[model samples]
Target: MAAGQPVVVLPENVKRYMGRDAQRMNILAGRIIAETVRSTLGPKGMDKMLVDDLGDIVVTNDGVTILKEMSVEHPAAKMLIEVAKTQEKEVGDGTTTAVVIAGELLRKAEELLDQNVHPTIVIKGYQLALEKVQEILKEIAVDVKADDKEMLKKIAMTSITGKGAEKAKEKLGDIIVEAVTAVVDENGKIDKDLIKVEKKEGTSVDETELIRGVVIDKERVNPQMPKKVENAKIALLNCPIEVKETETDAKISITDPSKMMEFIEQEEKMLKDMVDEIKASGANVVFCQKGIDDLAQHYLAKAGILAVRRVKKSDIEKLSKATGANIITNIKDLTAEDLGEAGLVSEEKVAGDAMIFVKECKHPKAVTILARGTTEHVVDEVARAIDDAIGVVACTIEDGKIVAGGGAAEIELAMRLRDYADTVSGREQLAVRGFADALEVIPRTLAENAGLDAIEMLVNLRAKHATEGNARYGLNVFSGEVEDMSENGVVEPLRVKTQAIQSATESSEMLLRIDDVIAAEKLSGKEAGGDMGGMGGMGGMGGMM
Candidate 1:
């Protein structure tokens, strides 16, 4: 290294954003993403119509869906997206709330930075606030039990009320509770995957029905087979009914037409024998996981047996659970004892598409909700809503705890956290107060989305929470009144709130700690011109994160 000579360190193409610039850029990007989905917050929240590059449109108020559909390119923005994704995966709801809180945390941290507060102090304050928030949440939470059917129903309805399925939420809530209850194990744990939501576009949302057994999006293999079978004896087969082809290619050397005819006859015999075995098993309805030979379909129809081929492996497993039928991989192994029984096996046309319905199972561990709507988009949204409802209900059962929604939980958290900040002595107390203020964004955003005076609503909400036993009181968007969320039947799983705060704080802390961003120069068609003017070469860097 020579004095007065510039040292060549990092590559010329690498882009480095250091110190305050890095933090500013990251916070700005995070705020932009937060603002993007901010409008889709509460019961009065509006839906976003996102159109992709191929012109495919998705109209949804779901936060995670909107974020995932958008082509987000900023690295820090993607981290915030991970917060929403984690929320969705953990609690199946509250993605928007998580992202919004994270954004507000970043915004507040930026203000603190401007005031000469170190990032470490802010991070420490957030961690303290997070711990206090969790303790306060447990204190404020209302306990729910697996047997509290009405409370569970309210939890489901709260999750569904803001989205596309609000009109049908009451019925959907009942269906969700029933489906989840049906699959609860002896240990009282609910597997959400056991409840399948099958959607179709044809009828109104109110017409959705719950099937005690599984529903397959497949019709009978042949139209000639019976459309409906009563007291169906279902045989679940994982193997194909078609003649097996030799794995190694071989020349048969059929020099004579008679010999070729004999070969064809042998193939027919094999197909007939497969059908005979199914008939001998006394299976009136066959759900095959593999392909069925055309000749075999003819024989099944002749035997008065309805067969559906190429069923998905997941559906097969679900059918076994729903119908109490053992899946037989080999045709020779099938018998009456290997068959599952259902009250009815029918092929019904929903939204102009044929689907197989296995209904009226006895003690089915898995079930399906046939969700119907008038349009493709409507059905899609209905499915999303149902999914959210199911997720919350399962969470409620698993944790056996819930809290008031409509921002009641957030308000309670904010109030208690501020009081908690008073006991602290250091500058970190300021950060704790900031964390409390950040949480108020939830109720504030709710009021803003509902066209109410945000300042007045926050003031009113705070005043209400200032009183004892008024913790459950929150802003009711419909009447623009602050009331008890529990009495209004607005409730959510406790996990939604706790997970949101945990995720937001952790993500904000991670972003605050990043004071430097080193990104490699991206290779693209336009940059091929070789113009490396300043930091312009780092433009449109989407994957650097």
Candidate 2:
């Protein structure tokens, strides 16, 4: 109330936007991110060619890959990207569907905002809708047993179908199913890390094959070693065969030339003794994680043993699982029980490079899928597709549940959610209906990407879901018509759909609740200069005083 009083000012370097301004900015950012990946939704979806600053180009229709490649700056947009990543990591598929749903949720929330509905109400409605959708998903999901190989194949086919892997979908599907089935333990636990994917560019994608054992991208340590070993008794070593140096610094004084010669002989004898212990353990093939000394290699070759040096730690672990072998770190402690058995281990030339394959393990808990393609990009894309296929198959085996794909699941959920929305009598009901509308974005985007009228497709899909058994009916991207996705072998793991909806809703709700954005001044050279100038002005004033 006082007149002509000094007023305090916020630092010029700090800026803040609140209320509608903040919400609008965030909504715009989320929508832009969704729009960026929208066109890459369905089988007919377009691919994005992302070129980084170094000019590394990544051309893909996979949502996670595209988002990962893009250098996003906006915080809201980054949140949407996280949604895709979580979907990708959780289910290994349905990333685009998740991101698009989140964007649509935000878009719908914006409409509610304009109608004077509070953000909390919108978030609550979204949460309620999410719970209902999850229940509907459980009801719609079909049970799949471990022995249901046909259904498993269909699941793999569905995952591989709409992407770069479509060209070789059937072959890749068979390989993926076989690979996953091979790695499933007796307790029904599937460790996907046991499955190794190796890509070699030269052959067609259809030439891709599954190896029943591990394949090391290396050759025998020495040329004199056997190129192929039958009935391989593999010894996995983590320690080096070479003589290790002392931990502390020390100098050895050579009294004469004869003493130096004796020192060299002693070192060679130690290396030979290490190799002798490996041979005594009855291991015909050696896979060492560390270096093998030159003397040790010579002794190994002399013993007619196949040896691979400097193997990766991951490969070594996979070999242990594949052959039921134990990795021994001490050479003197080697025993026959520590050796892994493979019917055959051979070093073969593949794509002009030498690689060793440990095959014919009786009951391998690990397997390999050697993916071959004509080009590097094709190989990379095929690898991604195979990864998705493996992921879905593994998830299905782990959870024992599957669902029909081709947007059928989305249509059914949308229809049921709308009916559920009617029972709730509040503004939250509107948000529930908004959630239903958001679910339709999947089929809509599918139809739109396939060059069909989205409105017409959604109408037909809704009508089909109205019937009791036609809930699995969805838009077939290939024919641009509604069909029974289950009968057509279009299926996915139940986890994929559940994760997509859950993550998308959660992300959208988080973004919707943000009411303000306060950005600190960036520490750029210009700002630093301005701060220095201000300090200099203060110094001049003090001198004048």
The ten-residue window of minimal lDDT in model 2 covers 536-545
| Candidate 1: clashing residue pairs, number | 0
Under the 3 Å rule for N, CA and C atoms, how many clashes does model 2 have? 0
Off by over 4 Å in 2: 1-10, 527-545
The lDDT of model 2 is 0.88
Candidate 1: residue 218 Cα off by (Å): 1.4
Q: Report the C-alpha lDDT of model 1 over 163-219, residue by residue, as the tens digit.
A: 988998889889889999999989888877888899888889999989999999999
Q: After superposition, how far is residue 18 of candidate 1 from its true place, in Å?
A: 0.3
Which pairs of residues clash in candidate 2, taking residues 3 or more apart in a chain or in different chains?
A: none
* Shift of residue 104 alpha carbon in model 1, Å: 0.7
Residues 145-215, candidate 2: write the lDDT tens digits. 98888889889988887778788988888899999999998889888889999999998998999999999
